[model samples]
Target: MMTYTREKNTQLLISLLKQHGVRYVVASPGNTNTAFIGSIQGDQYFTIFSAVDERSAAYMACGIAAETGETVVISCTGATASRNYLPGMTEAYYRKLPVIAVTSSQPIANIGHLSAQLLDRTVIPKDVAKLSVNLPIVKDNDDVWECEIKINQAILESCRHGGGPVHINLPTTFTKPFDVNKIQHARLINRVTIDDQFPLLEDKKVAIFIGSHKKMSKDVESLIDRFCEENNSVVFCDHTSAYKGKYRVHYSLVSGQEYNSIITERPDILIHFGEVTGDYYNLKIAAKEQVWRVSDDGEIRDSFRKLRYVFEMSLNSFFLNYVGHGTEINISYYETCKAKLDQVRNNIPEIPFSNIWAASQVSSKLPDHSVIHFGILNSLRSWNFFDIPDTVTSDSNVGGFGIDGNMSSLIGASLTNPEKLYFLVNGDLAFFYDLNVLGNRHVGANIRILLVNNGKGTEFRQYNHHANYFGEDTDKYIAAAGHFGNKSKSLVKCFVENLGFEYICASDKQEFLFQIDRFVTKNVQDRPMVFEIFTNSNDESCALEKMLSIDIDKKIVRKNKVKSVVGTSVISSVKKILGS
Candidate 1:
């Protein structure tokens, strides 16, 4: 048996190139290339030729590939030796020749340590190479898989999709042996965007999920509905999902249910689309084995922690082609989900007066076809449980999930539609943090702010939150309770008055209800508006707990199994639907 390179990265490189069907490798002499060269010398599958100069070897590979219509490999060691191939690689790139450059180097960590023969090749001008990435030092299976994908990506760029030269910077530990025969097969990775054909999913149980999203176009919505009906799919929507169409499952109503029951019915293929969600139940999806992220920006949003495929495409295009190519099933994943969803809708409780509770009561009062933005943490989670009208769109800056930008983001969104009423609900911490933007001249009358001034971050008071472990210590630092002084005095009253706008300050539920209708409806003056409702941190936490869990028989309990009369009815219906 012929001995091949025992090194994983070197073996990976060789196997992937072979997998891509590269027969010619023009090599220049160097000590770093010993393992790769020695391994391939015995392998008659490759047509290896030696050239003294690196530049000559590159041109030779290009000439061979261009003439034979085959991908050719150019191998060189580190330092100025690889730099000499730049001119030839540039020529090959412009001519669209399939020339792959494998530049071997000593461990990258030795770069700034004054090590001899050090060379940095991270920067390859776009004109010279289509894509350039280094094979990082492999520590585990993930690293190996990443290297395999990167190598395959390089291979794809070199030989397919308008062929061009691609650079692979290989860093070596130098002691890897050239004595193992028959390297492990490399995994091939492919990129599918809106421009390309999609991967089929006939046998897979596909689950489409939407986070906080702006209202999608009718075309996108119709395609999603048709696709769900055609496949064994379920679209999971929280209040933030914004997809109020057929086959939608509101999981937040039952997220506090049994975890096993939730995962048992969960789809193996989870397709995550839209923006960042503030749904804690959404985190349960990380349990799946594979997650396919769908985004138009070609981003790597590995939120579920099991990202296998990234479809860089719009939501409309992805589903249209996804369902168009795959086999449609007569199976019903929706009917069962719908029955349980119906039960959850009935269990919507009357929460205590707090930030979320107040918002839940009034979120419906905001006129249809308006824009609403939520502050991060509590505010986002609060509104996520309630349904927004299909015509009305909402946004939450959960991307950064910071407190300061909530008001600013809502204000910025209002600028686009100054004619529509813009409502923003946030706590005192967020309200005070962004008070400066309230005085901006650009602030318009179309904005209606539902400021839930709870005076501190009550999120710390929830036992489910990590900060709650600190108990009273949390108030001292984490919650910043009473940080900006008690809400006894009007903080933004003078500010709003100065800006030529109406300001409503509600200290109790009666005052809030009395002023809320006007706050939602009376934005006629089109001046900047702010509504401050005073709430305590305790009330906010109590309402949040009650909102997350349902009540029955006048008894409040939070658990996987709810046994109250009404709870029993809901649980019984859910279990019957699940066939449990």
Candidate 2:
């Protein structure tokens, strides 16, 4: 009886290799890779070759793949063994051969600890591999998912884009005994190109989700609209998606709210495009069984953890292929989502004077042909709930999602079109961190900065945030309160005046409303402006709570809670106790 290795990563590698039909493997002998090489040495699914020299093994793979036109994998141990494979990889890179170098390594933590036979192989020469991924030893479920995706990516990259060489540096524990029989279940995500046959989505309930994208052109928007209408689907977007179509649904509005049982029909398949989405709450609620991502890079982006395929082609190609596929019956998913979103849009509660309140006041008041940039977290989340003018576009540094470069990115974008106005909604910590960019001489009069000076990192003080457990103690270190002169009224005014900026300050809603028109209506003739609004963390938290609990039926909520606790007989009693 042939048993696989007990090592999980080794098991996954062998299983996916068999699934991908990679039959030829040239392996060099070493103890670090014993668990992997030993498991597949006698397996009928693979034909393993032995080469004592790592360099000879790698070159042999190059020759075999070049002649057979098949993906060839070369395995070696840690230390200088992988170093010798670089020359062959560089040759394969130039010739465009389908060769995969699977180098087994010791734990990265062991490197710099005087451990023998351990080399720092974190990064290799760009010419050596088109893609290099480090596969960590699997110990938990997250590790398992990561390892599987990385291995699948490495295998797929070997034969993609006219074929090229790639590297997978696998770390091993070297102690698991060969005791398992069958490998664990792993998803084999196939890449679909324009030339290849796409999956039949004829009668399936489809939903297209777009992330943070640049202002889309008219052609792309028209294609998306036609595809949605013909396929009986809807397109979900956020403030940054830049997609203004008929079937567009700002899903963040309904997804962020608490009592969201009104819309329960999930899509059968989700087609994702664009980059990072700041609306993570909607993403969690929108997970489906099958997800097809479209990207020209051909990389596997398993964002929803249910990725079925990756369409490696232009966005236009994907929409063109599926536009004519129609469903027989009328699908109500789009209507359901729109009705739910409209419910919140029409019944928006009066929020406290915080970031959310500020966004509600300014989002609809922005001028046309302008651009707005938001800082991550509070600023991004607040603006996602409101609707801006269709003519106004928006963007954020959600790719990296850091607070450091929020304003710098806004300033950089202002230089692109000096005639158009550019607005930035930033938090106190972010504004102070990137204050140096405001002093840049290239800043134009079309730049407008709305500094929400809340005197702390209000994100940490949210009602449901983990940092709330510490209470006031959170401000000491986690929130870093009392920093930047504790929102000194004179500090920013003096600094911006020297930097040639007309400064404005507001402490209350009346003050903000009185001065907001001047900030919004100011054209290119005015000096660069900064409007700083002072708020508190309590109001911020309250505003967030109000926005999330907009349309809750107290009777139904209490009934469900009571049913889960006891029986339906006590539903009325629970509702009465809950004041409904």
TM-score of each predicted structure versus truth: 0.78, 0.87
lDDT of 2 by residue, 316-366 (tens): 898999775564534377788888788788888888899899998999899
Pairs that clash in candidate 2: none
Predicted candidate 1 versus true structure: per-residue lDDT over 535-575, tens digit per residue:
87777777766655552423233453356445767888999
The prediction achieving the highest lDDT against the true structure is 2
At residue 7, give the lDDT of candidate 1: 73
In terms of TM-score, which candidate is strongest?
2
* Number of residue pairs clashing in candidate 1, backbone atoms closer than 3 angstroms, sequence gap of 3 or more or interchain: 3
Span of ten consecutive residues with least summed lDDT in model 2: 324-333
lDDT of each: 0.76, 0.87
